[model samples]
Target: MAATAVPTPPLLQISSTQPEPGSLVVEVDGEVDAASAPELSVALEPVWAAVSTRVVLDLSRVTFLGTAGLAELLRAADRADAAGVALRLVGGTRCVDRAIEVAGLAGRLPLSPDLGHAMHR
Candidate 1:
């Protein structure tokens, strides 16, 4: 008998909108863990490469985030900072919020309770 394989859930989904000049609003959904960190990095590469001065990461739809995800966020932030860009995280759920706080990145990275607030920041 042949064995059936189970499908793995995607690590994350990233979509972007250019609401205005010099900024990119990216919406991220689904889980971000060790298995999906590389994919997430690849997804954000183009946005970073575009030379935007500001990037907003919308995490309202992100349900799960692990250490790998947090590390990826920090790495992205560093790249943005080096490129003279600002990186902000918006609409983080409880788990995301706790993880950021626990990782001691709450202050280093701009964080807002919602997309509206993040965009304004």
Candidate 2:
């Protein structure tokens, strides 16, 4: 008899929302670092291609982040800008918030205190 193979679950979970037209809300929960940024990028590619101008990335549930993750965020922002879309991040933990500030992306990337505020901005 052959042994059964086990399936591996995705490390990141991306949920999409439609608060209004031409807008997309993506909630990501999981570690986003060098090894995982590519996965995150792949998950977001479809959303970016959908013509959603306003993109909100809720990172409240993200427990870990690294330079690669930050770079990925910047890339996403650049893509959004080129597409005439607005990208924002919301609800980060102290560590995650500090990481963004340390990377000198706080001013360049729109970040709000919470998801609600991010959506409004």
Candidate 3:
């Protein structure tokens, strides 16, 4: 028998830009799992550190969202609440939506259909 290797998911990529003085838009792409949650957390550090009152996390590009990803998102919501930051999740795919819905966090996390909706809300 020959040995085989399993395929691994791509690493998560997080990027952020401040379009205005008090607002930030963060775009997340690729898979989010236990291996990538830390990257997400590190990327969010600026969100908490900055004076931005509003933050929009764009997840439409996310290909996968695992339990660890969900947990990180919940923690993000808590951190936002405690910090008095208005955090919104925008543009998620079915995979992302299913994970959140299955975890019963759809109601708890602020979700918007797009960037415009997120900014308006």
Candidate 4:
């Protein structure tokens, strides 16, 4: 009998909330590498599309962050701008916050320290 390879757990998991109509908060948890970027985009596209007020990307639970993850955020920012919807990202974990800080995207990505702050801004 051949030994079969076991599949790895999903690198990313996305959960979402809507505090109000046209407002969304999608929470990301897990690793976000080049491998998981596509899935991240797919998960975000609809939320971005449906938002009329704002979209808050809550990244408190994310365990890892990569350049690909940053790119996805940038794209989401662009989409939100084009659609006239506000986009804000809330920093949760230290590692994820550090990644965005190191990438110099804090200014450009509209990042906040918490969910309440992100929603109001």
Candidate 5:
């Protein structure tokens, strides 16, 4: 008997929107590994260029986050700082939070518990 090959699903999905005049929100779902980290970086390109006062990255739906993903996040922070844009990370899953925490970046990154808090802060 021959074994059947299983198909792999896409690693990530990213979407962006302007929730208000001065805010841009990018919602990310699915896994963010080396294969998908570049996509996240691409999705954030506009964040570095936007004139918005605030940029929010919604990680509430992410299932997994890997080292490359963390690197992209650090890149986002650096770009946001250079652009003078306020970047907020919201609703990260335990997996995502743990990865960041283990990396000892919980304090360096702007993290909020929810969208409302992120928006207000």
Candidate 6:
């Protein structure tokens, strides 16, 4: 008997842009889980490295965010704090909001209502 292969879900999509001189915005779509968190990390490491800049994560389009995803956000927040860079999350899907709330990070993570609000601050 041949063993059946487990089907993998769609990978997360990440796009990065420099909205201004000292700001970076990363947009995410699809599901982010243990398998896809590495991609998230790769996209975020540079933002973390660039000290004294603001980084905003746009997650309104995200369908799902798992524990790994939340972990990465926490790490980014820590790095942003240490580097003196502002970090913000714009747009919150139900999954993203629930995950953050469950992780007890509703206040810790800088969350903005929309891109316009995030950009202004």
Best by TM-score: 5
**TM-score of each model, paired residue for residue:** 0.87, 0.86, 0.87, 0.88, 0.89, 0.86
Could you tell me the lDDT of residue 36 within candidate 2?
A: 88
Per-residue alpha-carbon lDDT of candidate 6 for residues 1-121, written as tens digits (9 for 90 to 100): 9999999766799998887888888999888889888899998887777636788899988888899988888888898888898888975678888888878888998578898798788
Ranking of all predicted structures according to TM-score, beginning with the best and ending with the worst: 5, 4, 3, 1, 2, 6
Error of 4 at 33 (Å): 1.0
Model 1 TM-score?
0.87
Better of 3 and 6 by lDDT: 3
Q: How do the residues 1-121 of candidate 1 rate in per-residue lDDT, one tens digit apiece?
A: 9999999766678788988898998898998899877888998888887856789989888888899989998898998988888888985688888888888888876579997887786
As a TM-score, model 5 comes out at 0.89
For model 5, the superposed segments whose C-alpha errors exceed 4 Å read 1-9
Q: Scored by CA lDDT, what does every candidate get?
A: 0.84, 0.83, 0.85, 0.86, 0.87, 0.84
* Tens-digit per-residue lDDT, 1-121, candidate 5: 9999999877798998888987898999999999999999888886777755989999989999899988998999999889988989995579888889998999877578898898888
Candidate 5 whole-model C-alpha lDDT, 0 to 1: 0.87
RMSD per candidate (Å) reads 2.1, 2.7, 3.5, 1.9, 2.3, 3.4
**Candidate 4 vs candidate 5, TM-score winner:** 5
Selected candidate, larger TM-score, 3 vs 4: 4
* Tens-digit lDDT string for candidate 3 (42-92): 889768768558888899899899999888888888888888989899855
> What's the distance in Å from true for residue 72, model 1?
0.4
Stretches of candidate 2 off by over 4 Å are 1-10
